[model samples]
Target: MTDQPEPGGRPDAPRLTTREAAELLGVKPETVYAYVSRGQLGSVRAAGGRGSTFDADEVRALARRSGRREPSPAGGDLVFRTGGDLVFRTGITLIEQDRYYFRGVDATELARNHSYEEVAEWLWTGELRPGVRFTAPSETLAAARRTVGALPAHSGSTDRLRVAVTAAAATDPLRFDLSPGAVLSSARSLIPTLVGALPVLGPTEADGGSLARGLWPRLTARPADAPALAVLDAALALLIDHDLAASTLAARVAASARAHPYAVVSAGLGVLEGPLHGAASGLAHRMLQEAVDRGSAVPVVADHLRTGRPVPGLGHRLYRGEDPRARTLFALLEDVPQAAGALAAAREVVATTARHAPLHANIDLALAVLSVSCGMAAEAGETVFAVSRTAGWIAHALEEYGERPLRIRPSGQYTGPRPAQPLPHAP
Candidate 1:
């Protein structure tokens, strides 16, 4: 009467029949088959013409990851996969038809029409405040500066920033408050603190003005100019957020666990080190610098291809055309007279790489042009990226804090030996 295997048969075997697998996973048999077709779960056909069987352990693991227990009030699962990416419901930003938006407004337009602070304020709340300035608290800034100053002399900007944020967190009594007002207050102070903690390399002191103006001196020794500062401001605004990036996902995970806003940012900063994320701009900066030195992008492009490393600063997974951020920044770079040579080098690199594959420039390449022209270090782009994206990470944290606590957990697939195997006696 039961669906179990016949008596004397291996009913409790590691391989399970389709019905047994479905029961364990809490999904319909059809859904289990869908998982197989998607390669999310593997199945083996029984001997001769019998039905397919699945690994019992694998099925349980999938069940734990899927976590598809109850239907929503509308009779559908709250979370579902689309094209192999987890989609989170958010009202903050949207990318559609190759163009991205912030709260339904074109992001590039927002960057162009408003200051970075104004744009960040809009992202945090629906209202926009013109000429807004995020001033750091005296005690927080002093603590961050003291901690950053204590780092090694050759420490990168990102390293100093990480230490600064940790120190700032320790000095704030209300850092644990998750309310919107408190979080926004912390964000305003934290952004300035991160910028203020950096060593000033330029004549333009970070005393008063827009955040971009404050950041300009820290990135380069050159004095700030209108056109150059414009590009930097737009770059900051454009880099604010890209829907659920690797670092943003990490930040969201931390926020879901009720970690303080500072901890969420620290989590994001930890994941921003690798080539695929924040450091990509630094790589692109090096490439552009080499291209300028050689007076041509041909050798640089050839070297990258010969070495089997995909050319950096070109192509984006999300866009079929040129990255919008890159396009905007490139347009802005045209206004900076000092950036002319670097801009030309960037365009040449695009043309050179296009012969092998039709790929367009991404934000990293545009950032490279700026850094190379402004006499900034290669890691300058990484610093700008980190400072610009903190607003976004905090925005995501705000959203995650409102969600169900600890909802981002996903089970890992186990590929080790069977559970009943004897333990090893020696190393």
Candidate 2:
């Protein structure tokens, strides 16, 4: 077969390869295909029909149009629930039969043996190399402490955490490296630094311990007993990843743009501050506290139902029966004296709710109970959640980094009024 000029191509028209077109548009090759599929740009078969070539002028025109204004569909027809459909694919974690599996290993089972660091390393590198450790550099920890300590005493933990992460990113000279090893190193350092820098109720010991044990003193003045520490460790493992949570999606989007690991974590943390996400645990904590004070779980649940608000710790959209994470944690608390009151209240709430509906306790509710049992503050549950889920965010960010860049951009649907025509002025 002989080569020929592209059909309808000008004799001197410039052509661009797929990679060149992607560069011009600041998109991935998959996105370029998306543009072609949507008829936003044109392409022709290459010489000998080997591959496709794009018209440089056409590609440039599309870029200019995109730059001028955001593109939108004709009508506001496209809609997807926040957790409804599978918008993207992931190999990190999966939700099946009301249980979560990380890389095909049962998370609840893994929690029985692995620490948060092991689970995090498994998620990041796809290997569960035993004896692997994650430690923050002395300088990074010092920087984080200085940054967090400067925050106002009344500042929320999340706000202080945000500032600390920003400072950590600014101090790391290798923040721009996007390679896998570099990204993993940054995540390892960032997690430990963040935990160590937070304000603590007591002095933290220098002795080597699990991540949960190290974080215990920071969350409350409660003694770091083995049972309590184990519960916290299991919670951390279970919350490591939940398959494309809102915060995870935000992190992935940031990573798609090649943002540094710290910046990607910051993005995830920003989304997690919302009540519907990370703060759900705080609401559950308050409810449990009220139940304990009132000496009855029925009244508290009844009041919540009467107020037309969903019980904070019960009912999950994805799980039909019960959250396995909640079940695992609740079971662990059954024999602990410190958690006795909180556990009793939780049971009563569960029994009362089951009479009226099919609702069951979720991970947030379990975390709340754990926080109260350990005598932590009302907002302490959210802190645990944010810290634990940082592992998942980093895992998802790494996954997105390996995929096509900028493939998460969503098309908008315009519903606003059309542009107005100019009117002639009278003299």
Model 2, 1-427: lDDT tens digits are 1223435667667888889888777778889878877767777777787667788877766765564222224422121222225355578888888878889889888887888889888888878877666687888888989989988899888987888898889889999998888988888888888888888896577846678878899899867888888899888888888887899889988998888899999999999999999989999999999998899999999998999988889888889988998999998887577899998998899999899998899988899889988889888888888888898998888878887677555545445666785675999
Choose the strongest candidate by TM-score: 1
lDDT of 1 by residue, 203-316 (tens): 865466899999999999989899999999999999999998999989998999999999999999999987789999999999999999999999999999999988899999
Stretches off by above 4 angstroms in model 1 are 5-62, 65-79
Q: Model 2 clash pairs? A: none
- Give per-residue lDDT, candidate 2, residue 16: 86
Evaluate model 1: give its TM-score. 0.87
Our tally of clashes for model 1 stands at 0
- The local distance difference test score of model 1 is 0.89
Provide backbone clash counts, one per model: 0, 0
Clashing pairs in 1: none
